[model samples]
Target: MKKLYHNYIDTFRGLSLEVWWLSLITLINRAGTMVIPFLSIYLSDSLNFTLPDVGWIMTFFGLGSVLGTWMGGKLTDKIGYYKVMLVSLLGTGILFVLLQFAKTFEAFCAGIFLVMLVADAFRPAMFVALSAYSKPENKTRSVTLIRLAINLGFSAGPAIGGVIITGIGYQGLFWVDGITCVLAAFLLLKVLHPKKAKILDVVKVENPVSAYKDKAFWIFFIAMFIFGFTFLQYFSTMPLYYKEVRLLTVLEVGLLMGFNGFFIFLFEMPLINWLENMKNSKTKLIAFGLFLVAISFIVLNFTSWVGILIIGMLLMTIGEMIAFPFSNAFAVERAKKGNQGEYMALYAIAFSLSHIFSHNVGMQMVDKYGYEFTWNFITILALLGVFTLFILLKVLKKEKNT
Candidate 1:
C-alpha cells in the first residue's frame, strides 16, 4: 500500500506550478458546473416543458458552444489566451446569473444559448494556456492532471448540487455556479498574471501547416465528434435513465453520477502515468476506450438488474480515463503543425458540434422509440467511432512512413 501510495504521488512530481494553478482554476470553475448536468431535468420537471422543448433548448446550447469556440480560437491566435480566458470566465459567470431570470421556453432557450456561447469559448483558450504552461515531455501528464482536477470538482459538484436542489430548489444552483465562475476568474487574475507567470509561446513551426488542410485531423475530428455525441449521453440521457427506469431520487442520481468522477479521480492519473511510461500505442488505447463505451451502453439491454447500472458506469469511466487525455495530447501534438489555437479550436468544435445534436437526438429517440432503442443507437455510434479512429491511426502511420 505504501509503495502504491508513493507511486501515485510520484506521478505528480514534475509538473510546473503554472500547470497546478491552471488545474486549480479548472477545479473551481467545474465545481460550479452543476447547471448543465441537471438542466434538462429542470426544464422538464420544474418548468414543465415537454421533452422536445428540452431538446431544442439543449440544441441551442450546442450552437452557442460552436460559435464560442470558433471565436475563442481566432482571438487566442490574434491576441493571447490570457485575455480571452479572463474575459470568458467573467462573461460566463455573469450570464449564468442572468439566465435564472428566463423562465419561459423562448426566453430560456435564448438564455442558455448566450450562456454556452460565452462558456465554451474558454475551452480552446484553456488548451492554448495548457500548451504555453507545459513542457513537451510533460504535456500528456499535464492534460491528465487537469482532467483529474476536473473530475475531482465534478465529483463534488453533483452531490453539492443535489443537496442544493433538494434544499433550496434549482434556482440555488445558478447562484452557486455563477459565484464560482466569478471566483475562479478572480483566482486566475491573482495567480496567472502575464508578468508573474512568464507564459511562453513555445513551439514555432518553420512552415505552419493549416489545420483545415490536414486530412488526417479532419478524420480525427469526425471520430471525436462521434465520441462526444455518444459520451454526452451520460449527461443527457443517463440521468433520465436513473430517474425514470431505476426510480432513483435526485440525490441518488447525483451520487451515482458523482461516482464516475470519484472513480476517475482515484485511478486516472496513475493509469495515465503508467500508460505514458509503457509507450503504448495511443490510437489503440483510444479505440479500446470506444469499445468499452459501446459495451457500457449495450450491457443495459442484457439485464434489467439495477446493479448493471454500476457496472455500466464503471466501464464508461474507465473508457473515459483512457480516451480523453490521450486524445487531448494528440490534438495538441497535431496543432504544432499550424496555429495551436486553430487546431485546438477545430478539436473543441467537434465536441461542441456533438453538444448541438446529441441531446436533441437522444431525447427525441427516447421519446419516440424508448430507452432501449436509444441505448442501442448510441452503442452502434460508439462502435462506428472506434472504427473511424482506427482508420485515422492507419492514415497517420502512412503519413509518417511516407
Candidate 2:
C-alpha cells in the first residue's frame, strides 16, 4: 500500500507548477459559475422577474460569451494565453462584484453579460495553454485532469451556492462568486508567468480561416452544437424544472448536481483512455453516448420521484463524460497544427450559441407545452446529434482514403 501510494504521488510530481496552477484557476472559475444553474430561480423568485424575462436576460449573457470566446482565441494567438487568462479573471471578478448593486432587470442582465463575456473569454486561452504546456503523450490526461478539477469545484460550488442562497439569499451567492474570482486571478498571476511569443511562433499555419473548408470539421462542429442543445438543460432549465414542477428542495437540487461531478471525477480518465484505445471506431462511442443522453431524457419524462431523477441524471452524466472529450479529441485530430485556438474557439462558440437558443426555446416550450414536451424536444435534439456523428464518421473514412 505504501509503494502504491508513492507511485501515485510520483505520477503527479511530473506535472509542472504551471499545469497545477492552471488547474487551480479552472477550479476557481468554475466554482464562480455555481450560481448559474440556479440563476433562473434567483431572477424569478428573488428579483420578481418572469420566466420569459429571464430568457431574454440570458440572451445577452450568451451574446457576450459568443463574442468573448472569439476575441479570446485571437488574443491568445497574438498576445499569449497567460495575458488573456489574467485579464479575463480580473475583469470578470470586478464585474461580479458590480452585479451586487444591480437594481433593475436590465442592470442585472448587463452585469451578468459582462461577467460571462470576460469569464468565458478566459476558457479558450486556458485550454490552449494547457495543450501548449503539456507533453503530447500526456495531452489527453492533462486535459482530463483540468476537467476533473473543474468538476470537483463545480460539485462543491453549486451546493455551496444553494446553501448560501437558501440561508442568506442571492446577494450572498454573488459575494462568494466574486471573491473566488479575485482569488483565482491572484493565484494565476503568481504562478503563471506571462511569456511573450513572436507572431511566427504563435501562428504556425498562418491561415486559420482555411479550416472551414474541411468537411469533417463542419460535421463535427454541427454535431457538437446539437449535443450542446440537449446538454445545456442541466445548467439552464433543470434546476427550475425540478424546483417548480417536482418540488425538490434547494439541497436536493444541489445534491443532484454534486452527483454529476462525482461521476466525472470517478470515471472520466478511465473512460477517456478506454475510448482512445477503441480501434478506429471512436465515432461509434460518440453515437452511443448521444443515444444514452436522449434515452435519459426520455426516461426523465415519466419520473416525478427524486430517486428516478437521480438515476436519469447519472445516465446523462455518463453520456456527457463519453461524448465531450472524445469530440474535442476528434476536432484536434482534424485541425491543422498551430490553429487549434481558432478551431476550438469555433467549437466553443457552437456550445454558447446552443445555450442561447436552447434555453430560450426550452423555457418557452416548458411554459407552453409542459415538461414532457420539453424533454421530448431535447430528445430529438440528441438524436439529431447522433445523426451528425454518423455523417462525420463517413467523412473521416473518405478523408482517410484520400
Q: How accurate is candidate 1 locally (lDDT)?
A: 0.90
lDDT of 2 by residue, 104-132 (tens): 88898888888888888887787777766
For all predictions, the C-alpha RMSD in Å is 2.4, 3.7
For candidate 2, which ten residues in a row score worst on lDDT? 195-204
**Model 1 residue 205 lDDT?**
78
Pairs with steric clashes in candidate 1: none
Candidate 1 stretches greater than 4 Å from native: 41-51, 163-172, 242-253, 304-306
Tens digits of per-residue lDDT for model 1, 103-128: 99999989998998888889898998
- TM-score of model number 2: 0.85
User: Would you estimate the TM-scores of all the predictions?
Assistant: 0.92, 0.85
TM-score of 1: 0.92
Model 2: per-residue Cα lDDT at residue 74? 80
